[model samples]
Target: MDEDSIDHNKSVIIDIPTDLESNQWSKCWIHRIPRKLRKVKESAYTPQLISIGPFHHGREELKAMEVLKEKYHQKLLQRLPKDGSVSNQMEEFIRDSYKEIHGRYAGLSNNGFDDEDQAFEKIIMRDACFIVELFQRNDSKKESDDDYILSTPWLKKAIKLDLIMLENQIPFFVLRQLYTITAPHLPSVNVPITQASNHMNPFLKLTCSFFKDHIVKESDWEKFAEIKEIKHFTNLLREFWLPREFIKRRNPQQKDIADRKYLYSATKLDKAGVTFKRASKGTSLADVKISKKPVLKFIPASKGMKLKLPELKLENDTECLLRNVMALEQCLYPKEDYICGYVALMDQLINTSEDVDFLVERKIITNMLGSNKEAARLFNGLCNQIPREKTFYARFYNDLNKFYENRWNVTRSTLKKVYFKDLWTGSSTVVGLFVLVFTVTATIRNVYLRHL
Candidate 1:
């Protein structure tokens, strides 16, 4: 072969450093929705009302909110002491922290404003300031009645959903830095932002208010005070929904439930003599348990067994919200895919409309999707792109399967279903047995008399 041809035949090898050896910044939790997953439901991953981060910046559709962002920025600055220096201070902070902010976004390209430091600073400052102002306005005491976004219910809801999208997030520390700078000038509420010792963080309070509908009141934000770093709004929301114990016991290296061969649906378990019971209000959905006794006294005791499921509030936007969170978990925390594991467990438990019905009747699932079929479809679709791996509820699934497989439990369930199919049938059976016994007694007595 010719020397040129020989050279061409040799493959060029480029060595990339391993995750350990690479000086690569930690995995930026913020990421664009992967196309494979996004194709399933594009709208859920895309920002509809407003875009917060660089992922959707400069899109024509989201341009309308640009003016609104500017207005909010001005309003926030207006709240500051009348000195012109506050704007300069904010600009300086953004410039100083620009590198840190840039490092927090995954797959950030240098093509857009990478060389334009001032432009990047402007975008971050404006976006961060707008978010802080929006959160501040959500609190009723500080909100103006005439606010355009707040006045329009649809817009407000859309904005909230948009802000929580994985693609539409800024690092939490960036927002916190901005908040710390402006907190002194902002109006005071029941909890002041300046009190670092207090359990209630102003940033957290703002986030909870913005997503109040999804948050459980039982969430203790005080525990979060000890968390030194939080990734972004999406991460915070995921953490908020988790049980305190789960958070404390969580080990990133621990293997999940991916090894279990079988997972039973609610209906299947019910037929196997396992009674479905709703968990307490504050219980994390991840804390599913199977036990011989009902976890809550309000739930009637049933023979054989009980399965407890945490309360999941379903709504029109729940599917969209959950899908994004699951996607984030899959991308950022593959080893500790808590959200993905939860969705996988739910997918197993809700394979059909019948399963949805079983959960709905027992109050284990609230079907806000207008139909049980729709709710079933929502859950069944979530895990389609998710990798099937060890789930968080593997132990619960394994234990419940063992209980359901018991021969005695199955026989008892079948007998109860057949003999006591309904009240009228059961009553008639009892009456008929009574009459037969009485007739037999009379006949025997007459026979004895005849013999005598």
Candidate 2:
């Protein structure tokens, strides 16, 4: 645990086919990355969480990646222009085929189902997995603890969660992970992102926790020792996704912005990071003294004593302790999905809309036909559903006493007054209501579970 030895085994290396000059890394990227990221540990640099922006930290990077991807797709179009030939005598045929595909896509319209929340979320999840995999093999880091790597998915749940993310990109990783002698052997695949939804196979969404002395909790770290799916994880990164850090650097920023919540672009390098105050670890629940007595942790609120955990509570008991504890499931909001899509739509609209004042002017969503109007509608709908204001230990609280008290009423009131009905009409209104209800329910559920 000594700070001096934290660099042990941290070197990493990445091999790529580069047509550029050999000295290019230093010239092109050295100034961009921080020193710590550039350090030659056992093999490569340690990975970092790619966050950006104030209220919406992860948005910029992912959005940039999406834009870059679309740009690449267009470039591909340019490579074989609408009239380009595939074979000696296939010029006309290929052009016709391209035209048909383009026409079909165009017919779908901008308001099509192409930009669903699930689709956007899938992009983020895949990108996260890509970053994880990039570090797993291409960039290996030395360990500070012979015990656990701070960044790797050493926990069973983390790994499984990542695998779920992986399925969106490289289906082969799933196949290989499932069949490989080493089940966790994540590998790369040349598969397209839209290749298969069947990749959701074995997409596990489990909610189980390890009790204080439970083996499942204790052994969560032990699973990483198994050298299983490194390759599978690696390839999935290389093919369909790029490192979060890569995308993070390219994000656009607002002028004159600075806030604790705001995450600026991230850069990786072989240098040390700025030493902010490390989160305090000695703050213990049972150690807080009450009435001049060292508290060894009693159930907060005498009522908690009556409520036993689900596994141990009685079924016959009316105000069942198990049910009370079980009622504590957390329902998470897909804030990223909602916000990302909203931002993208807003960007598109603001950038290309013929009329900017229409939304702020009439304020009638239905009457406003600009794409941004629909976008603003969707954004407000989701904004209404997500938990905006803060909650209190509540955040990372491990104990039941420090529970969450939601500020949902404020958010609800905001939604109620927004005049959503004006924006989404008829069938769209109904669908919006349904989605809003579902999102609210899911978010409440997620919070309850986490707090419980």
Candidate 3:
């Protein structure tokens, strides 16, 4: 810690132990986004996404989610905030959150959604704090009651009026997040049936298309084009225009469809999944009545999946926004939980804080700007006058300048400042940076001279 090496970090390091067992399963440190959920929106877009009415969002009925997902893959042609925060800040959050959940539950697989009954039952039951507690202590209905937990008065208030299903004890919060569509029908089909769909059923296709066409109908294509800088029908082109190639891929009774969905959803769920069924569902102490023949074999309908946004599942623009919000509210946890959260924050505050290269670049500029005061002093002078709002990139430029000038002696700090600096960027000090590199020949020369 040289006097020349001004402490770049304004705050002191809180050296928490990292001796926890290796979390090979966590991806907080890695560069991967989960597989996208391919949901279709029902009907038109509402500024406030009131389902407006009961509508289906089956993936086959709508490739909109898949379409929106593809757009996420495309460079965000435009965004409101434009700082990369609004669009992707949560993605990294999810990756790390998934990692923490996975590590916390050792030996669990990533695609744990498919076996939601057996696997995630404990997790959801334990984690569903408010609702689970209500069921445990308050619900007066016995397990033998006709409606069971549905008989609880708290449930009626907790669930949205839009939701008609009361039999299955799916968490109301979970149902809301899934964008479940419900009518006053006999069998309430709480969609998100399985993490991903088993079949792109034709009726499913009709349902999805109904929503798709309706959304597109109301879309102001001209206005969207204006924002996105496209020539015409950009909404339709980007949102609905099919990949002429999709027709080739379509086939009924393809054995692979079910397998692909199974494998893909399972793999995605394995990363991070929770069960719809609560732990208290089974209280029967009597000897099990194992039926040799099953009753038309039932698979869990409300299986959970990682909340991949509209981009991967590519829905209409509005739908994408809604789902993205849903994911953040549901899946993401506090940033401090993941290694990336710590590192990302460190990068911001330390390496690329307000005065991004304040310590290193100033030192380099002071040194490499040839002890010259012009660039270095001018930089410091500007920094002192940095408008609070402009300090972010201004400090970046200051360090970047030093990096180029004293490049030969440039430290890792310079590289980070010039290249990435996306971290904190909320810096203040325009300090100094100095990295000393010793060549073998130089070392030998010094040694020989000392001996002589």
- lDDT (CA) for every model shown? 0.76, 0.26, 0.25
Ranking by TM-score: 1, 2, 3
Residue pairs clashing, model 1: 257-390, 257-391, 258-389, 258-390, 258-391
Question: Which stretches in model 2 have alpha-carbon errors above 4 Å?
Answer: 1-125, 135-139, 142-287, 291-452
Q: Which stretches of model 3 miss by more than 4 angstroms? A: 1-202, 213-440, 443-447
Better of 1 and 3 by TM-score: 1
Highest lDDT among the candidates is held by which one? 1
> Of the candidates numbered 2 and 3, which has the greater TM-score value?
2
lDDT, candidate 1, 1-452, per-residue tens: 99987754442211111244544535567877766688799988999879797878888999999999999999999988777777778778888887888877766764566456676677778899998988787665537466788778888888888888999999888888788888888866443343322665677667665666554242445546655567888887677656557677665546645346558888888778888889986676566676676434775654467777787878988888788878888777777776777777888888899999988888888887788888888888888777875766677677778877887677777876777679987888789889999999999999999999
Cα deviation at 337, candidate 1, in Å, is 1.7
Candidate 1, residue 185: the lDDT equals 84
**Cα lDDT of model 3 by residue, 1-452, tens digit:** 76444543321221111334664534221111111221122221211211111121122433333343233223221322456553343333333344343343223333525454333432332222222222222222342144322454443322322121111122222212112211111122322332212343312322222233323222322212222121111112232322222222323111111111111121111122211111121111110111112212473432221111111111223223332222221122222111112112112223212222332332211123333223233222211211122111233223323323443323433444554456434231121221123456678889999999
Measured against the true structure, the TM-scores of the candidates, in listed sequence, are: 0.84, 0.18, 0.16
User: After best superposition, candidate 3 residue 166: deviation in angstroms?
Assistant: 18
